[model samples]
Target: MSVTREKILELGENLIRTKGYNAFSYQDISSELGIKNAAVHYYFPSKENLGTSIVKTNIQRFEEMVDNMHSRKFDEWQQLDSFIKIYVKSYREQKKCLVGSLSPDYSTLSDTTKQELKRMIDIILKWLTELLDSGRAKNMFNYNDDPTSKALTIFSSLVASLQLSGIVEKVDYKSFCQSILDDLKP
Candidate 1:
């Protein structure tokens, strides 16, 4: 990506995570990046285009992150902790998960954006499923009644934990993550 394009995408991701997708505009990105609104248009012709681009890039980035984790040879439990950290990174930065941040606005999303969002979510869920499967196989995790449900619950909990932390913030996110990890322990 051109520096300008990358700048817009990075800023756009942060903006969307901080503000809802419907709440941000190219003008917001343009102003923050010290560029003109039309310049933002030059990179992404429409808001949907920009949103879809963010979704696509986020999906790619997340897939690459998981791939990197796999290469590190983390056992299933360790990988699960690392996976929680992936989502926690955003929370620690006071931003939202890329996919979870879109949930409330899902009904309003453009078809293409919605599809990309689903794709991003599916990728994470699939990785979680595989990890859980591995953990079960190794007797490191005992929850196997429904692997997919467990994956979804863990993800949904992490997402909720971040959102809830933003609200009352009564509990630490790391502790929240550990609770999920504990449940998986055999």
Candidate 2:
């Protein structure tokens, strides 16, 4: 991608995560990046196009991260820890994950953006479900609920906690994450 295109994506993603998808405009991106509003339109064509592309790009990066973990032969525990770390990185940056950021605006988003958002969420859920199932079988994680349910619970907790930390005072983000891991400990 050209530097301008890549910068647009980065800024767009940051805006969506920090401010809701509906909160920012092409003007916001254009002003921050010193580009013309038409330039953003040239790359994304429309707000829906930019939103969809942002989610799709995040999904692609996430898949690559998972593949890297698999290649390194990360154990079930290690895999999960790494996954949680993604949220921690977002927390440190004071930004919500793409799913958390876009969910509240789901009703208003274009069909294409909604579809991409759901696909991104499903991808995470599937990975987490498989991780929980495998970990339980290997005695790496201790959880009573079915893998899918547990996956939902864990994913919800992580997203909620990250968003909550942003608004509430004195939230120990790392400890909160560790407690999630603690719940899975045998």
Candidate 3:
């Protein structure tokens, strides 16, 4: 990617994560980057294109994280911890995860962007479900629900927690994460 393209993606992603997808315009990115609106348009002809690209990029980064964890031979506990850390980082940054950020505006997204968003969500959910299942089998994590259900619960909680952090003052995300970890203890 060219320097300008890379900067556009970074700024676009930050805008989408901090503000809802519908909350920003190409002008927001263009102004911040000291580039003309036409430059952003040249890279991404439409807001939908930019939105789809951002979602796809997030999916790529997430898959890479999962692969890295597997390569390092992270156990189920370590995997779960690592996953939680992603949300914790987002909370500390006062930005929602890509999925959480886009979900509120999901009804208005273009079909292409919606498809990419679902694919991104499915990838994360599948990984979490498998990890939770493996953890339970290994007696590393305990929960009553099926692995998929439990994974959804955990994922939902993490996403909701980030949103809550924005509205509800003095939210202790670290303590919130530890409670999640504790809930998984046998």
Candidate 4:
């Protein structure tokens, strides 16, 4: 892909992750990229088209990162932290997880875009549950219920922290997440 096109997609992802899919326009991306609206259209054609590509790239990069971590023999605890690290990077960049941020726009999104987002999130859930199960087997994590449920709880808690910070004044998502992770320790 062209460098200009890549810059457009990166900016689009940043915009969607921060402002939301509906909250931004091609003009927003163009202005950020120092390109004209027609240049963005030449690459993406429509907001939906740009959004679809961004989601696909996010999913691909996330899956590949997890796969690489697995191949490197990262233990369950390390894998879990690696997962959290991805969200931390997002929080540092825009103060929200990619999927957690986009989820509010699901109902308004195109069907294909919704499916891609769902797939991306499903991968996160799957990896989390697998890590939780492994941690349980190794007695590294403590939870009375099943790993799947616990995984959802962990994910939901983080999202709530993120949303709360966005809603209330100064909720501190990273500190909240670290506190939860501390409690989850055995």
Clashes of each: 0, 0, 0, 0
List candidate 1 stretches off by more than 4 Å. Answer: none
For model 1, the local distance difference test gives 0.86
Give the per-residue lDDT digits (tens) of candidate 1, residues 40-127.
9998999888899999998888888778877987788777888788767877898888877889899999999999999989998999
Write model 4 residue lDDT over 64-175, tens digit each, in one string: 9888988999988788777777666765665666677778888888888888988887887888998888888888988787888888888877765666666787657578
**Which scores greater on lDDT, model 1 or model 3?**
3
Colliding residue pairs in candidate 3: none
lDDT-best of 3 and 4: 3
Local distance difference test scores for all models: 0.86, 0.93, 0.93, 0.81
For candidate 2, give the lDDT of residue 180.
Answer: 90
Per residue, candidate 2 scores C-alpha lDDT tens digits across 1-186 of 888989999999999999999999999999999889999999999999989999999999999999999999999999999999999899989999889999999999999999988899999999999999999999989999999999999999998987888889988888999999999999
Q: How many angstroms is residue 175 displaced in model 2 relative to the true structure, after the best TM-score fit?
A: 0.6
RMSD of each: 1.2, 0.7, 0.7, 1.7
Instruction: Show the lowest summed lDDT stretch of 10 residues, model 1.
Output: 168-177
Candidate 4 weakest ten by summed lDDT: 86-95
Instruction: Give per-model TM-scores.
Output: 0.95, 0.98, 0.98, 0.91
